[model samples]
Structures are given as structure tokens and as C-alpha cells.
Target chain A: MSEPRFSVGQRVQIADRTPPVHHRVPSYAKGHVGVVERVCGMHANPELCIRGDGKPFQRIYRVRIPQTDLWAPYEGTDGDKLEIEIFEHWLELAQ
Target chain B: MTGHDDHDHGRTFQPDHPEPTSDAALVGLALRELLIEGGHYTAEEELAVIAEMQGASPENGGKIVARAWTDPEYKKRLLINGKDSIKELGFDLEPYEFTVMENTDQVHNVIVCTLCSCYPRALLGMSPAWYKSRNYRSRVVREPRAVLSEFGVDLSDDVDVRVHDSTAELRYMVLPQRPAGTDNWSEDDLAALITRDSLIGTQRDLSTK
Candidate 1:
């Protein structure tokens, strides 16, 4: 990844789309909103690498999402949350 | 068993004649042979690596956690860059970004791989059998608190449970809070308290008893 487009503490949403291909963004995190918890540096775009193409590297971020938002009536504590690594392409600025 | 026998030329693995188990074994066999044929490595070298990995006990992680307990400065670096910090202790976690999640009075952290069974093998050795099961990968992210209870880590409703789902390029390790009664304990003694499951956040509260 040339430059990181997202910053820590900024709100963002994981791309909700599901393509029937090998990808890094897990299905559960799709379409959910989370905050960028860490800029995990650049990595080879996994989607491209799956097709044996690795030219483009993409920035990765660790997004922190409240468990309640991810699962309604989440049984854990109010502060319970999940942090997952999402690539730059799978995320968008959320309101 | 048959592993050493097969590698020692007991059975010819032709890609065209693939059996059920042979299909998966094909990938590893091919790579191993290629490395040997290319002179990039030898079977002895390969076996040595396998031996080293097999010998790499979870104590590797215990040593790191124990050192972090005694050295605040090392702990800070470990939280920031877990890969490098562990390497400072002669352990290597290459190619992947290793992030250490700390557990405290207010928050408890757990590690998982929802997409597949990814783990920080180079640091913590092989993942536990339960970690690779579909049940864990699927359930832990959705109901972490309940799963922690099943692991015998019943928490007080006040503590926040944070789950870290790793990707192919990244790995996470948990830095559990040090037990209170062992301030004067030696690093080796403290390390004995850090269990493999504790390093993964499935277990907490290292007991000096």
C-alpha cells in the first residue's frame, strides 16, 4: 500500500459485499461499522494474490467494533468489542 | 510412522495418481522435494526445522510474557511491536505482524481466526486442537463471554471481552495481567505460571498456587 487512507480513531465500515472468492474480510464483519484501532502497515492485496497477481500492496487497519452493534442483544458486557484486521479496500468512511 | 518412510522413498507420489490424503500431501511433498532438488535446502535441513518447531514449546510464549511482567519497558515495546520484542528474546515471528493484546481489570482479550484457523505458530507453537475446530472459530467471535466461561474463565459481567480475529498477514498474542502475590518471584518461576491458553486469552489469572 502506497499510503494509508484511514487514520486511527476514525469511524469506518467494512464493505458488505460478498464475492464467492478467497478473501480476507470475514463475512460477519461485512457491512458493520467500526473504528480504526491500528494502522497495521502495508500487505500484498490478498484478493489479487489469490489470483497469483501480487503487484499491488494495500494498507491494512485493525477496526474495532462494539459487540452490540455486530450482534443485537449481545450477551457480553456493554463494553465488549471485537477488533479485526481489514484491508484498505474493504473499508469506507462512515458517518 | 509412515511419514518418514514415505519421505525416504518408500512410496512414489505421482501427481496424476492422487489419493484422498495424497492430494493434500502433494503440496507439501512437492515443496519439500523442490527445495531439496534445487539445492535451496536438504532433507536434513528440513527435518531440523521441523524438529525445532516441534521442540518449540508454549514456554516460548511464557518466557516472553514473564519478561514483560518484570520489565515495563519491554512490555511497552511488546504491546507496540510484538514480533520484534519476542525476537529480542531469540524467538522469531517473521513475515506476519504480531500484535500483543493486554488484559486488565476492565477488559479481557481473546484470540481467534474466523476466516480460517490462523495463529502465531512461530511464537506460540501450534495452536490448540480446540482453536482449529470450526466450533471455536465460528462461535467465539459471536459469543465470546460464553465461550470464555466454557474455557473455565467465568468473568464478572463488568469486564469487557475483546476478541481479536487474525488475518493471514497478522497475528495476535495476549499479555495477561501479572498475578499479584509474586512480585519477588524469579522470571523462570513467573514464566511457569503463564499457560499456553492464557497466552491465547482463553485462560486468565495466572495462579502462583
Candidate 2:
């Protein structure tokens, strides 16, 4: 069981890689940088559990991504935000 | 297998007859059969379980919201741990995390499960049909303003929108800003304003007007 690498308020980028397997990270959020909203506790690795292996538990974080950064020609206010839960492996600390 | 044929094949089709069972429904039926056959749970037990789940409704959530509006201490606790706070009111979201999003003057919160229909059933009862639709799951995360406006909740530009995607174990409920002209209203009256859609953040500005 690995401790959480990212803390709340830290900037992290979603892993751009899209493997041909089941995952929780939404496609629109892939490769985008977002701030960690909250550090959710560990959860069973869904990607692994689907294939019958649930040994490794993962630390999940709620990442807050601005809608303007997500969609080009954004029509909503700059304050508009989209927050989603991302597993540890799908996120990397971004500059 | 009745196709809309131009030829008069049937005298009259039953308007009440729905289409064949969907693939997901078939799979669910199969799983239920297997479980019953294996003596895991009796058919009556399954019915009882479903009956309890269907019995849940938004009124349970309204009680909590009304309490939070009237009690500052309970509100603080509810904001910190929604699942536990609700247990005080005889409702719980165990085996899952329940987070309450407070709607302040500038921040408006909405809940959606983009990957799937992961709703706080313990609070909002069963998830509405639209909440589980692909159209909402995809569009709300993108054009939230448009989607919100369609629901008759038009927010000002200063009010930031936060769409909480319940993709994981956690479930969320929005604590709407208490309506005006209700200062003297009892908790029962206040609870009446906490509609299912308002709790989900699709409706804003709860009012007696």
C-alpha cells in the first residue's frame, strides 16, 4: 500500500496514455493539468479488479479542472470548473 | 418483433406493450436467476430488498438540509462528513463516502456521474432516468451552462459552476442557499423547499415565491 503522492492544492496532469483497457479517467480530462481538490482515501484498483486481480489498493484524488482549459471556444464563465476522481497511476505532478 | 410496416399486418397493436427486454435487463435477469438457483437469496428476499430501496425518497435528504439550515453545529459536521451526519437523522451512506457541497453566494454545485450513474441513493432515493442517460452524462460536463439553463437554473456570470463528477466511491449532495422570506418558517416548511432537483444542484434559489 503506497501513500498518496499528491496532496490537496497541488497541480497534477492526467496521464495522456490511453491503454486499451477499462479505466475511470474520462477522455476529456486526459493529458490536461488540474489542481488536486481533495485527497480521497484508498480504493480498490477498479482497472485491476475488473480483470480479477484486486491486490493493490490505490489512493484517489478529486481533481478540479477549469472548463475553459478543457473546451476550446469556451462559452461559460472562467470560474466554471469540472471536478473528477482520478486514480494515482493516471496522474503525474505537473509544473 | 413488430416493425413499422406500411402493409396492414396487424389489426391493432397493443400501445401498452413495450419493446423487448434490453440487453442490460436480460443480464440482470440472468444474474438474479443464478443467485436464486444457487440459494444465495430467495426470490422473496430479493423483492424485500428492492422494496426497501424503492421506499427511499428525497424527504430523507430534506430533513438533513433543513437541520443544517437551522443548526450551525450540525451544519459544520454535515459539511465535514455527510454520511455520518445523516446517520444522526436515521439515514446512512455506508460502504461509500458522502460529501456535502455547500452552495455559497458565488459557487453553485451540480452532481453528475460521467462514467456511470453513481448517485447518492441513500439520500436522493433512486436515480432519475435522465440522470442515468448518456446525453446528460456527456453534455453536463461540457456545456454545463446550457444544460443548467435547460433545467431553468440560469446562473449569473459571477457565480462559478462546479460540476462534481461522482466517478468513484464518493457521492455528493448540494446544500442550497437557504431561501429568503423563510426566516420565520419552521424546519418543516424549509424542508419542503429542498426538492430532489435542488439537492442535485439542477435547481437554484429556493424560494417561497
lDDT of each: 0.85, 0.85
Instruction: Identify the runs in model 2 with alpha carbons over 4 angstroms from their true place.
Output: B1-24
lDDT of 2 by residue, A57-85 (tens): 78889999999999998778999999988
Off by over 4 Å in 1: B1-22, B27-41
Which of the CAPRI classes, incorrect, acceptable, medium or high, describes model 1?
high
Highest DockQ model number: 1
Candidate with top TM-score is: 1
DockQ, Cα level, model 2: 0.76
Q: What TM-score goes with each of the models?
A: 0.90, 0.89
Give each prediction's DockQ, rounded to 2 decimals.
0.81, 0.76
lDDT of 1 by residue, B21-106 (tens): 66668677777667766879666666677767777777888899999999999999999988788888998777788899999999
lDDT of 1 at B106: 91
